[model samples]
Target: MINFPDDIFSEPADVDPDTLANLGPLTRLAGVWEGRKGVDLNPKADGPEQRDYLERIEMQPIDPQANGPQLFYGLHYHVHIVASDEDTTFHDQVGYWLWEPATGLIMQTLAIPRGQVALASGRASPDGSGLLVRADRGGPGYGICSTDFLEWAFRTDSYELDLRFNADGGWSYVSTTMLQVRGRDEPFRHVDKNTLTKVAEPRPNPSARIAAGKATLAQAHGFTTIGGGAGKGD
Candidate 1:
């Protein structure tokens, strides 16, 4: 269990404005990436279906966030996927990838348009080359939630994601989701894997850009101070 401090209302005193520099293992993932040879395997009415897909991902830094004494540096990420044989979208996801430097706590909070959302948690070294996080159906902190239709049809029992950064300046990930299909007696393992190449670099978070005089407050409208600083938009 995580230990809680007595002073829950007091925020951290010295929060750095540079989010990119403090993202720990998530630093390598801040960028736009594309993958052409992605693979997905899912359960079908008959059995299972496999498809090749194309994926594009954008990961941009967000201003530092805090919950009282808890501080986090993170990225706002969006993923779009299309099948190789079709122009229609196969999957779309948006999420935040957060890291707590003090505890090496890494978390991923994801939401899909098809009525599902999940929070996964894990631990990684500050300079690690790989990362992993998982979520189960019923948990207090890190867990999955779905709509009633999804629960009755294709209930998601668990989710896991594994990521590896390569020496060739690219990264890869494999995601596995356990599903309980309507009629299936056993759980099905739906999986997807892809290797992405960086296509663009990330922009600095709002506060960082402002601190460096690269942007004005008007451009950083939604940003708020994290620690011992002035009020929002001040």
Candidate 2:
């Protein structure tokens, strides 16, 4: 079972709105974005295949999450990709971009359509522009998981994503994944890169909207209550 705190409803010092603003650099990514010029390299039966694909990634801000003194502001994101020539899904990923305000820790949880998942983590400051996160195989902390078939045929050893924010209002990323294919003498480096432009904007959190609605109702009913912050339990 997923391990989480038990008393998650207890009031904390900082509430959801504060948490939203404190997510560091991730606040800039809280919107829909698309890129058509993503390039990917993967292994095939004969050899390596290089292809160009289209990518769409959407990251939305979430209410702050806390475990006692530890606080986090981040985005729940979905990444979708398709080959330029074909309409079928080339790749799909769902994950979270988490940031710890107190520790400058950035984490990424990735779940792909190919029956695999990983939790990658690293550290960065609020001032720096670039970020690199990584995960390794067979590690309990931030590690990788794969299906039995995939594990036997093509084992993935490590995954890394390097993100760079451009001066122009755009962002780019380079992904390098190391795989241990069966019958191969050495590990293969599969690389992919993409640059994204903002096609649209993000919406506010549902809880925020609901809270606004509740405030309206409370005002209509003349009830004044003060409880605003991230809860402390599951």
Q: Number of the top candidate by lDDT?
A: 1
State model 1's lDDT: 0.92
Question: In candidate 1, what are the lDDT values of residues 1-234, reduced to their tens digit?
Answer: 779899988888878999999998899999999999999999999899999999999999998999999899999999999999999999999999999988888999999999999999997744688999999999988999999999999999999999999999899999999999998899999999999999999988888978988667755655446662434342
Worst 10 residues of 2 by lDDT: 214-223
- Specify the highest-TM-score model's number: 1
- Models 1 onward score TM values of 0.93, 0.83
Candidate 1's C-alpha runs over 4 A off are 125-127, 222-234
Colliding pairs, model 1: none
lDDT accuracy of residue 33 in candidate 2: 93
Report lDDT (CA) for all predictions: 0.92, 0.81
Q: Which stretches of candidate 2 lie over 4 Å from their true place?
A: 1-11, 16-19, 125-127, 210-234
Q: Write the per-residue lDDT of candidate 2 for residues 172-199, one digit (tens) a residue.
A: 9999999999999988999999999998
